[model samples]
Target chain A: MDKLLVSKRMKGRLVQNAILQAIFFFATVLGLIALMLLLSHVVMQAIGWLDGDFLNNFPSRRPEEAGMKSGLIGSLWLMMIVAPVSFILGVGTAIYLEEYALKNRFTAFIQTNISNLTGVPSIVFGLLGLTIFVRELGLGRSVLAAGLTMSLLVFPVIVVAAQEAIRAVPQQLREASYAMGATKWQTICRVVLPAALPGMLTGAILALSRAVGETAPLVVLGIPTFIAYLPSGVLDTFTVMPLQIYNWTGRPQEEFQHVAAAGIVVLLGFLIMMNSVAVLIRNKFQKRF
Target chain B: MGIPTNQEQPFSVREMIVENQRRQHWPKRMEKIAPKLLFTLAALSVLVTLGILFTLLFETIEFFRRVSIVEFVTSKEWLPWNEEHGSFGVAPLVTGTLLTTGIAMLFAVPIGLASAIYLSEYASERTRRIIKPALEVLAGIPTIVYGFFALTIVTPLLQNVIPDLEIFNALSPGLVMGIMIIPMIASLSEDAMSAVPNSIREGALALGATKLEVALKVVLPAAASGVIASVILGISRAVGETMIVAVAGGSSPEFTFDVTKSIQTLTAYIVQVTTGDAGYGTTIYYSIYAVGMTLFLFTLVMNVLAQYISRRFREEY
Candidate 1:
C-alpha cells in the first residue's frame, strides 16, 4: 500500500510539471501570434488605400483626394538635415571619449550621463527643441529646429554604437599606424576609422531609423497638422509619416483611419529598409575582417 | 658597437628644428583645444538636462502664480477649458495612468516571464535564434503603429468577446501596451536568466527535479533582482508612452474603476491640449509643463532606481 501511494504521488508530480512546461511553451507562441495579427490587420487595411496618388499628392479635406506628398517631402527634408548633423556630432563625441579623453571621474560621469540621456522621454527633447531652437534661437518650427531636436533624441544611440565600433578595432592596428609614424589624427582618420566605418555606419543607420518614426517630439514642436504644401528648404515647416498618421487617426472620419493604416505600412517599409542596410553592412564587414 | 655617421641621419638638424618649431607655434593651440572641444561636446547633455528643468520649472512657476498649488493638486475635476473658472483636478489623469499601466503589467509579467524561461531553458538552439530576433524586431516597431493596432485590431477582438467595451476604452491601449512591452520584459529577463550559471540548473536537475521546477524554484530566485529591474524599466516606458495612449486612448479624464470606460492619461492629456486648442501663456498651456514635470520626475526616479538595482545588487554566477 505504501509503495503504491509513493508511485501515485510521483506520477502526479510528473503530470503537473508537464502541464507547467506546456503553459510556458504556449506563452512564447503567443508573441508570434501577436506579430502576425498586427501585420495582417495593417497590411490588409492598407492595400486598398496605397497607390501612386496616395504617395504623390498633398493632404486634402477630402479623404479620396488626400495624399502624403507634404509629409514624404518634409520627412526627406528633415532627414537630409538630421542625418549629417547627428552623425558628425555623435561620432566625434564618441571618438574623443574613446580615444582622446583622459580616463578619470569626469569622463566616467560623462559616459553615465550619455546613457541616462537616452532614457529621457523623446517628448522632453521636443520641449528642449521648442525652448532652445524654436524660441531662444528664433528658428521657429522649421525643419532646422525639428532636425536639431531629432539629432539630440538619437544622439546617445549613435554615440554608443560608434564607441563600440571604435573599441572593436584590434590593438595591433593602432600600434601599426603608430609604428609607421602616423600622427594621432592621421592614425585615427586613416587606420582606426576605416576599420570602424562599417560598425559606425551600421550604428548611424539604426539611429536614423529611430529618428524616422518619431512623432511625439515633432508634435510637441508644434508641427502644423494640415500642411498641404511641401517644405522646400530647411527653414520651411514640415511633417513626417508618423505625424501624418497621427493626424489621420485623430480625425473623426472612418475613411481617414484606413488612410492612417496605409501611412503605417509606408513607415514600416522605411524602417525595414534602413535596418536591412545596417544588417548588410554588418554582415559584409564581419566576413572581411 | 659602431656609432651612426652624420650621413646616416634621417634629416639635417636645421630642417628638423624648423618643422618642430612651426608645429609647436601653431598646431600646439589646436592640439591643446581638441581635448577640451570634445569635453564640451560631452558636456552638452548636462546642458540639455538643465534646459529641460529650467523650461519646465519656468512655465510651471507661472502656472502656480495664477492658480494655487492646493487647487492644482487637490481639485476633483480637470476642466481647464471652462469659460469662467476651470478646475484643475489630477485624480482622473492619475487614475487613468495607473489603470492602463496596471492592466499592462498584468499581461506583461506572466507571458514575459514564461517566454524568458522557455527561451533560456526549454528551447533548442535553432528555435532560440529564430524567435529571439523576431521578438527584437517587435521592439523596433514604432509606438504610433502599436496605437493604431490597438485601435483597429485589438479593440475589435476584445469587443467581440465583451460586446460592451467603449470605442476608446482604456482596456485596448493597456492591453496593446502589454503586447508592445513584452519584448522588453522578455529580452531583459532572458539576459538575467541566461546569466544564471549552468551549474545551478545542473544541480537542480540532478536532484530529481523537473525542468519546470528547476526554472521556477531555483533559477527564478537567483535572478529575481534582475527580473524586477526589467519590470520597473518596462513600467517606466509604459508610463512615459505618449503616441500609444494619445492616439488610441479617449480624451475623457474620469476617475473610475471601470476598464471599459474611456479615460485619458497624463501623456494623452498633454498631447490633446498642445496639439491644437491651447495657446501660449494660457492656463491650459502652462498646465502641460506642470504635468510634463511630473512625468519627467516619475520616469527619472524609476529609471535611476532600475539602474541602481541592476548595478548595485546584481549577483554574478
Candidate 2:
C-alpha cells in the first residue's frame, strides 16, 4: 500500500509538471504567432496604399487621393514643441531628485505622484489639455496645446528614465569631479550628463515613439481630421499618423481599410527604427563600460 | 598643495582674472538658483496630479448637479442620449468595462504568467535575448493598431468559428487586449521571479525538487505578491484601455456577461459622447466626465493597491 501511494504521488507530480511546461510553451508560441500574424496581416492589407503619393498628398474625401503629408508635418511640428519642453523639465526634475533633493516626505511625494501620473490614462491627460491649455489658456486644440499635453503625458516617463540613467552613472565620476572642486551643478553638467546621454536619448526616443502613436488625446483635443495644408507653426491645428489611421479604420467604406493598414506600416516602421536604436545603444555602449 | 599649484604652474594673468571673475559670479548666483529651479520642475509633477484631480472632480461635480450621484451610480441603464428623460445609469458601462476587463485578465493572466515563468526559468539567455524583445514589440504596438487588428482580423475570425458572434463583440477586443498586455505582465512577473534569490532555488533543487516544482511551488509562492502586484497593474491597464474596446467591442451599452454580445466600455462611451456628437455643457457631454471620474477612481484604487503590494513586501536578498 505504501509503495502504491508513493508511485501515485510521483505520477501526479510528473503529470502536473508536464502540464505546466506545456502551458508555458503554448503561451510563448501564442505570443510569437500573434506577432507574426499581426505584422503579415497589416503588410498584406497595406501593400496597395503605401506609395509616394500617399506620403505627399493631404486628407481627401476621394479614397485614392487621400494622403498623409499634412499629418506627417503636423506630427513634426508637435515634436518640435514636445521635445524641448519635456527634456528640459524631465531631466531637470531627475537631476534635482537624484542629486540635490533630501530624502524626505516631499521628495517621496514627488516620486509617488509622478509614478501615479504615469498610470493615468491618456484620455485624462486629454481632459487636462482641454481644460488648462485649450479652454483656460486659450490655445484651442492647436499644436501647442496638443504638444503640451503630450509633454505632460511623457514627462514622468522621461524623468524616471533620466533618473535611472543618472543613477547608473558611476559614483566615482561624481566624486572625482567634486574632489576637483566642481560644484554640484558643475559636476552634474560636466561629468554625469555626457555619460548618461545614451540612456537619456533612449528614454526620449521611446517617449517620442509613444507620442507619435498616441491618438485618443488628440481626438479629445479636437484635432480636426482633414487639413488641406501642412501646419506652419505650433499654433496651427494638426493631425498625426495614428489619428489619420484611426479615421480611416472607422469609415464604413471597404477601401479605407487599405489606407489604414498602410498607415500602420508607416507608424510601425517609425517605431521599429527608433526602438532598434534604443536597443542598439543599450546593448552596445551600456555594456562597454 | 592646491594653494601652491598656481605658483608652481605659473598661472597666467588672464587665467587668474577669469578664475576670480568665475568664482565671484557664476557659482554664487547660479548655484543658489539651480536647485530651486530643478525643485520647481520636480514639483510640477505634483501640479499635474492636482490639475488632473481638479479637472476630473470639477466636471464630475458639474455632471452631478444635473444627474445625482445616486442616480448615476445606481441606475440600471445608461442612455445619456435617450432624447427624452435619458437615464444616466453607470451600471451598464461599469458591467461592460468589467466584462471586457475580466475576459482580458482571464486570457492575459495565464499566458503572461506562463511566459514569465518560461523566460525567467526555462529559456536560456540567448533565447531570452531574441524572444523578450519580440514580445515587447507587442506592447509598443499602438492600441489603435490593436483596435484595427481586432476589428479587421480577430472579430472576423471569431465570426467564422462562432456564427452567432456579433461583428464587434467583447470577446475579440478582450483577446486582443490580452495579447497587448502580455508584455507588461510577463516583464513584471519575470522581474519579480528573477528577484527571488538564487540561494532559494539552490535550496529547492538540492532537496530533489524538479525544475518545474522549484518554479511552481517555491519561486512562484515566494514571488506571489509581486505577481499579484503586476496583475493588478495589468488589470488597471485593461480597465482603462480605450481604443480596442471602442473600435471592436461595438457601441452597445449592455449589462451582460456574455462575451459574444456587443458592449460599450466606459472609455468607448466617452469617445462616443465626445466625438462632436454632444454639445458643450450638455448632460451627454458631462456624462463622459462623470464616467471618466468613475474610471479614474477605479484605476486609482487599483494602482494604489498594486503600488502598495509591490512596495510592501519587496523582498530583500
For TM-score, the strongest prediction is: 2
How much is B74 displaced in model 2, in angstroms? 0.7
TM-score for each candidate, following the candidate numbering: 0.93, 0.94
Local error of candidate 1 at residue B89 (angstroms): 2.3
Local accuracy of candidate 2 as per-residue lDDT tens digits, A106-207: 999999998998889888788788879988999986999999999999988899999999989988889999999888878888889888888887888788
| Displacement of the residue B133 alpha carbon in candidate 2, Å | 1.4
Which candidate ranks first by DockQ, i.e. highest? 2
In candidate 2, stretches whose alpha carbon ends up further than 4 angstroms from where it belongs are: A1-19, A283-289, B1-23, B314-317
The window of 10 residues in a row where model 1 chain A has the poorest summed lDDT is A280-289
Q: How far is candidate 2 from the true structure (C-alpha RMSD, Å)?
A: 3.0
Model 2 lDDT at residue A97: 94
Off by over 4 Å in 1: A1-11, A287-289, B1-12, B16-30
Q: Is the docking of candidate 1 incorrect, acceptable, medium or high quality?
A: medium
Error of 1 at A47 (Å): 1.9
